[model samples]
Target: MGMEHSILVRVITTIMPALVRKEIQDETDRITGKSKQISPIPIHLSIFSTNDIAQTPYYDFLILPVVNLTLIDLPGLTNVAVEGQPESVVKDIEKMVRTYIDKPNSIILAISPANQDIATSDAMKLSREVDPSGERTFGVLTKLDLMDKGTNALDVLEGRAYRLQHPWVGIVNRSQADINKNTGLSFARRREREYFATSPDYGHLASKMGSEYLAKLLSQHLESVIKAKIPGIILLINKGIDEMESELDHLGRPVAVDAGAQLYTILELCRAFDRIYKEHLDGGRPGGDRIYGVFDNQLPAALRKLPFDMHLSLQNVKKIVSEADGYQPHLIAPEQGYRRLIDGSLKYFRGPAEASVDEVNRVLKALVMESIRETEAMVSG
Candidate 1:
């Protein structure tokens, strides 16, 4: 069976693997246990043998019925290659496990078989690296019945070595004989309780052994973690609410409180526009003088400063006539000719007038936008 089956079997009821229809079995056995009817045959099994991460959720009805918990059983960290896996596979799995354990919110559950050396286990070593102070890491010692005769993990369980904030918990997994006989998990749990209760070497530590006790301990630990983070969570929520309120204020509507107030604001804007228009037309200092004064006075002054002979030349008259009439000839009566010549004389000045009006209009638009911005700023403030 795969890790998914192992996990579900540990925490939930037994799920029988289908003997027929591999595809249907794979689809049906999701969450409970992945069907092994379609087992893959590879020349070599790497840490990424399946080339997928199994995200299994575990729920305990017997122990922490009211609380739900999720536990991840990562690939076993080992340099040994019983299945022809390369040595690099061990390192790759170590890196993957370290990435998850190093996260701030993670709680490390370092599971080491009691039959093995606790200090030498790769799982325990990795846990130490993530939790240097041993504050959040807990140990679960499995296969209590498999340990050699006259040997026990009492020292590790009692925290004499590999000390963690939460002491080690011991559990007994189902033996091969139990599995062959179709013995359920309840029997396995009862067997564990009995072994720890009667055995001279483990009876005193009965409170710390068995799956039920471990589940209850984990539930309590999670509750404490939630309680500890409540204040910080609340603080963040309040900060987000305040930020949203300020943003809403910043984008508030431009409408005034009442009709009279809105009318007054419109009138004030109209007056401002009128004042600016008059100022621009009159060559006031507020409007740059270049638009009106340069064409009106400077060109004439420069022309008058020229020598009298040069000023009276036909070329000069022709140039003025050409510039005024835009170089296009048109027949007219004497009276109309006088009016057309005057219009031509003022043709060069039309540019400045148009430019001045455009500038004033641009300034008025900017003032309106600024007033809106100021109103919004006041509301936000």
Candidate 2:
């Protein structure tokens, strides 16, 4: 499932050119069908705006031969809105980046070109903000060949500068000129190796540098992270399987295939359900007990799942009381704080109440389904 260096470069060469841009109108017009950006039938609107902020669509590409890598190419980090771009574009991109990187599971790949100011790398800055320890962050330094005269990324390449848990691997990818000349990635890799081996500043560090090392490091990082998560994933999967098996056991055996048998089964199922319904009406166990459980069991279960303790912790309660006091401490209860706390706590009950109703509904529906399995075949057909 891993893509080799040559194959990866080939994919980049063919699919990952300078990013493709699309022209679009505003989201309001886009959704209202007043403007068709790209559609089967062309419909141009006169009131279309040049900068659209309403909708952002994800672009996906499928390569025939798959690799272990799954990439999410977000909008490039930028400080300014160039030319006709909307003013909010920068903030919007930063917000989107933050939403993804803030997640505990995501692995941040912070990349910067050698020519770019590493101190000002928005990608690394955002990564550090979300992952201050840099545990989940992997840094990449590209375009090592493009650095200014008499300068080298010796410190960064060796993890002495801008250190991350995973050290930065420097890459000397093909230039625009080489791409235009239709050079192959295998050839480009050879040149990359040659450049690193020959340069006096980077010659000794050739083993630790280049695209090959980056690919290996990335694969190892993903593997280690995935291995760490396997136990939790397996536990969830096993729990789901157990639940399914229990539900199946509750459903009992399947009905026969013969039409006559099915017809008889239907009658017997209806009678059984009727008997249970009558017993429940007469205050019996099978059906009547579930109704009692709605209040006694389901409601309590739902309440336990709510974060009442978290919301009403000592610190939080004190803060609320302080806020209610408004610069004056109360001798007795802060009546306003008590009222606010009660009101807030009461709102939490709404969810549990609704969940209890839903649980009862599920119990009823499941009972009905179990009683009517004879009709399942016809229904499915």
Candidate 3:
């Protein structure tokens, strides 16, 4: 479990703030005891770090009140497939890394041993594949104390070999011997701090080395990313709201309550049509005076119920009385004479009278049809 313990310690040490590291250390001790099987399986470690922007005698106020950083441990990358491991395993790990780092707001921390040339490291290559500009990737040079004699990563840290936007940070990793000896993490951390401070090559980078410094650097980067993305996040939210509103407009409002409500609505619409029918058909209102259209239907039988012969004779008598010259001697009337007068009057008046009736009926029909269309719209709604 040497590799496993090393991986876990690296992640926990980097993620946990000074305030929460003790809790994790206690948990680790509990797990490694005689009852190791009952220990909770850790997926990722959550570490809380707070930076104070102001401090007084009473209390300190944090600039970033609380930043929770979660570190996920993935399988290490390998250039060549191992003897027992299938070639697909290596490819699968690479695919996983690519998928994770491709997320829009993701930042990659590429950890490499200082003894190896970072230019050829699989971790550094994966970082570049996902973040071509190197803007979202930070380098952590580990195992600095294990470098070959007369060899150092000063050039790599300074970005002479590979140009990284963020300068590389150096850290001394706990050795296999340290784990075999069961050295406490606190002792290991102090050893790391002393190694950087005393070593001539890495002494210059003392302030920028070690896990605590690395954690602070990551926190600052995370805060910067959050600040930069706030406006864009709000813009996306507003855009979503507008799209939802348009969809609601197309959907319209809900009004159907029950079968009876629907029936009442339909009846109310019919009543409005009834009022229009009475106004145009009985009152002869001529519906908006738009008298232009064709009418094929004949006048109703009720219109022809007028007493033709008696009404015509009365009208003729009134006309004669009104147009009398002096004497009234046409009392002795002939059948053909009455027929000629009546026929002439009918010929002059019939066409215009029928046309006027048809026109009025057409306007009334249009009004009724319009009312029906409006009712359909309401029912559909």
Candidate 4:
């Protein structure tokens, strides 16, 4: 059994992992015809010991109902080595959790028992290490009914305690007895709803409580994340198509073409490069404004920070004037000495100037790459 099955039983037991897209018109497409279907589904378990956390298995399941969410079912955090487990199991699990959470693109679902102290929660502790603002973390408090008779998790659910930018949800999960008797999730969910809807402590906010609400909340969150990334994905796809078309067109063209054709081809390539360059500088594209920022903000800022006073101090200026006027010093205006002093001081400006040029070059390269990925640069077809 996977690690998720344990906690998921108390939380999202009935809600199995789902497919991103589904088409069920043909039943034969889903089921195998025994001998004819030699290839099994892509789900596989590694041929390694279960105790080895590093040998984690992965699967690509063809599921229905189209939820489009994936969860990495990692092992629970441990305080010490159990009898059969490795001595470094606790550290190993913590390292594994951090590995997944450290990714900027991942969303963390931090679940903890409501009866325990939230301040000492291992899940939230690890989550905060990676996501200090709690932006990508969703806090789930399970076993709400397990708390003492006089105490409740009202402060946690309402955000008065251990406040987070993202909201927390409380769940009164089914007990061991309910699971042993094989009670349906619907009945457990009904009981959960009744507990919250009628409780003097939770009734005021019953609408936002229970497992059903949690499902809807997670669904909406996943949908919003997917929607946010769709535009960028489309841009990449279109850019790839444009690149392929251009490459094919170039390869198919004659190497021994007429002079007029060669000139036209050269003009076309130049025009394409020119248009892209202008659009970038004019802020007509997404990353276009960076070029202006490099010139206006960064270059000026770098120039201002140069040590002008140190470079042009009176003692240093005098030394340079003496070096310039060594043998044939200008008799009257001393133009050579003055020019030498000015040129020596100007040397300090070279460092910032070169640095600005390098920064601008890098920014232009990134801007040109992004412009090709923009809708305007992509092939229309």
Compare the candidates by TM-score and give the number of the best one: 1
lDDT of 4 by residue, 1-381 (tens): 121111211111233212101121122234533212211122222222223233224633322232334556556777887655567767877877787789988988898899999998999999998999888998989988878999999889889888877788888887888866666778889999999999988898788888899889978887898899999999999999999989876555445379987898677656766676677778565555766677789878988887778767889777877778788776787677788767866787788778878987888788777655452333322
Candidate 1's displacement at residue 130, Å, is 1.6
Model 1 residue pairs with clashes:
none
Q: Which residue pairs collide in model 4, if any? A: none
Please identify model 2 stretches exceeding 4 Å from their true place. Answer: 1-69, 267-381
> What is the Å distance of residue 125 in model 1 from its true position?
1.0
lDDT of 3 by residue, 1-381 (tens): 011232232231234344344555565555544222222244334322333255667765433324455565455776676655556766766776676678867778899989887878988988888888999999988988878999999999878888899878888867888766666778888988999899898888899889878888988998898898989999999999999987765555555589998788668768866765565555555555354333323333333644556646867756644444335445555444456556666665566568767777767678788656655555445
- The number of residue pairs in model 1 that clash at the backbone is 0
lDDT of 4: 0.70
Give each model's whole-structure lDDT.
0.65, 0.71, 0.68, 0.70
Candidate 2 has its poorest 10 consecutive residues by lDDT at 1-10
Model 3 regions more than 4 Å off: 1-70, 180-182, 242-381
Q: Which prediction has more favorable TM-score, 1 or 4?
A: 1
Candidate number that wins on TM-score, 2 or 4: 2
Candidate 1 at 91: error in angstroms? 2.7
- After superposing all C-alphas onto the true structure, candidate 1 shows an RMSD in angstroms of 10.3
Q: Which 10-residue window of candidate 3 scores lowest in summed lDDT?
A: 1-10
RMSD of each: 10.3, 25.5, 14.2, 21.4
In model 4, which runs have C-alpha deviations exceeding 4 angstroms?
1-67, 253-381
